[model samples]
Target chain A: MKPTRVTNTIRALRFAHDEMTQADLAERIGVTRQTVIAIEQGRYSPSLEMAFRIARVFGVRLDDVFQYPDSEEVAP
Target chain B: MSKILYLGEAVVTHEEKRAWIMLVVSVIAYAGYVAVVLGRQDGGSLTAVPYVGALLWTVGGAMVASIVAEIVMGMANPRASRVKDVRDREIGRLGDHVGQAFVIIGAVSAMLMAMAEWDWFWIANVIYLCFVLSAVIGSLAKVIVYRRGVPQW
Candidate 1:
């Protein structure tokens, strides 16, 4: 697996949101289930538009859905 | 939650399985073509041989086999899942770019051979070899990218 500085709370949010499935999130985001799986596994990072879309699907802000750990630790 | 099985092994995704099928089909078709062409040569130069028939058969067979394999794969996994996504598209483009390098290499080599007044047999075979290499290497790259994570850029 490739290392990524970016991380996300999608899996947790999905579980918290009425136990939403990956397929559910994917359908809502207009992407494939595999894409959702990839994102959850940190194998892929979505585009900015997709990141916003994902946040919107969960009724959350972009920062609540995704985080850049390296940048976060450095900024503050 | 159904999965497609090939030779008793589960295939993860439609695109991955398709890559495997294309690789296999290309190899088999190319091997058959080489065998037939070389078998007719009897240790003589193959320059006089007519290869259009073999070339057509190999290319056509690979295409047909790939289509059939995809159809069967779809039937086996009838969830109507999305066939592609952003990641898939990126990986595909990466593979195509890698494979295209071989096509350029082949073209340049063929041009050099033509300048050297090589036989048509050599030029044609070189071009065909390059195409086969492109397909095989490209599909292999896609399979690798599917298994490993695609590189971040």
Candidate 2:
């Protein structure tokens, strides 16, 4: 069965980080604000590189910002 | 200031009335043209006239419409054609991908038809089908990508 799922608080985290605008994060990571919006809303799952970039921007590990609610996800 | 370039606001530059007028005129013209082609005294050959006329008329009309619309829009706002956003880029990319698929599918089908001794009429139909299908599928993909928040493709 597909388990009940949940999403992240990247938007909240960004706000906590001095109210960073989507444009600011997008510019830092060479994407667009629309892409940033998509990610924060869980409508898009970013590529590994993009996830790392977002983590770097937040000055934290990737897991600190994003996590799948299920416990069976692969670890690298 | 590091060379501040002003971004133009999004607004409907081309008047809807002008656009609708152009639309109706083009539709009437094309329909009249097709009717004339179909009503010939000799009732000319389907291969010789109707199909060719359609391919010519539809494409010619579309080109004319695009040019007219672009000109009208540009008249209202010089930068009406510029789209400097990620959503626009993704939509265009989605179109390009669908178009590529159409070309590949058409070419393969044409080659198979050629091997079976199909003639030039078949090739012409194949080309027309390629273009029509490409446009339809491309537009559909664009809508899908845009509403669904970006496509993996």
Candidate 3:
């Protein structure tokens, strides 16, 4: 499958928060560690509610956690 | 030590194991049915072979086997998390959708065969084949998604 256009900073946020493990973040967000791994690797894009929940765990805004590539940014 | 083994082994989730179980059981059951029916052919008309009993036994056996396998797996891995997370649910839904297409095809084929005055053997076998294909393909899809990540959109 193609990588998701959405990118996230979950790994960075997890590192900032006492170097939290993926399992810890998954438990906090009610998802599997694999889901967290996928999201961090840009292999899967979380649902809107899930995205908010993830950001809430990191105490950040949705955009702070996730970013969509801009059309202009893609065109070199 | 367990840590060394863990580092060497690929991480697998409970749902992925269940998918593997389903895929394996379906293929085995279908193969068993085919074997029994073909073995009975005895150089005669294939339709005359008694397939209903074999079909029923294999299908029923598959269900029982799957449940038993799952129970055994759970018993063996007492510490494995049994929770079905959102990603698991989504993957299951996606797999079911992919599998359901084969079910529709099976149903349509059965209907057409019945209308065409085909023997019960052909109709029943067609439906059974499709059901097995559905289970196999669906489980495969789930395994692939688990390994490769769910497709976005």
Candidate 4:
């Protein structure tokens, strides 16, 4: 599968939060650890609701957790 | 030891393990059924070989095997979370969509065969084969998605 255009700073955020384990973040966000891993790795772009939930877990704005490349940068 | 555990952790998820178990059990059960039916074909027509009992037993056995395998997996990996999250649900839906194509093909084939007055043996076997194909392909799809990561459109 193509990698999701949406990239995230979740790993960095997790690190900032005392080197939080993926499992702990998952628990806080009500998702499985693997889902957290997928989001962190940019393998899966989450649903809007899930995106909000993740942002809530980190106590950050959604943009702080996820970003998409500028349209001009992605064009061929 | 840490490296090995990390490697194991990186490789598979609980859902992937279930898919692997389903794939293996389906293959084994289908192979066993074929072997028994073929062994009974002692110079008689393949269609004439009694197959109903074998089919029933194999189907039932596969169900039991899948249940037992899941139980054993849970026991072995008690630490692994059994809950399905959003990603798991999406993957399952996608895999089922892929597998359902075979099921529809099987159903249509059976209907046509019945209309043409084909032998019951051929019709039954075709349905059974499709069912096995559905299981094999579905679980295989799930495993691949788990490895490759779910496509986010």
lDDT of 2 by residue, B1-153 (tens): 211121233422122223344445445545665565566526556445545666577768766876777677667777443424444565567667876788788888889988888876677768656765665566566555544555443
Every model's Cα RMSD, please? 4.8, 8.0, 3.2, 3.0
True contacts kept of each: 0.30, 0.11, 0.27, 0.34
Candidate 4, Cα interface RMSD: 4.0
Look at candidate 1 and tell me the lDDT of residue A71: 44
| Model 3 regions lying over 4 Å from their true place | A1-3, A72-76, B1-10
- Candidate 1 lDDT, B1-153, residue by residue in tens: 322111222325677777889888989999999999988888887987778899888899889999998898889867656468787888889899999999999999999999999998899889999999999999999888877667786
Model 1 chain A: weakest 10-residue lDDT segment is A67-76
Tell me the tens digit of each residue's lDDT in model 4 across A17-75. Answer: 77777877778878877888778888778889988988888799999999988775555
Residue-level lDDT of model 3, residues A1-76, one tens digit each, is 4547888888888878877778788788888777777788886788999999999998999999999877654544
lDDT of each: 0.83, 0.61, 0.87, 0.86
Candidate 2 runs further than 4 Å off: A1-6, A71-76, B1-45, B50-95, B112-119, B149-153
Looking at model 4, the pairs that clash are none
Quote model 4's TM-score: 0.89
> Which ten-residue region of model 4 chain B has the weakest summed lDDT?
B1-10
Off by over 4 Å in 4: A1-3, A72-76, B1-11
| Winning model by DockQ | 4
Compared with the real two-chain complex, what DockQ does model 4 have? Answer: 0.38
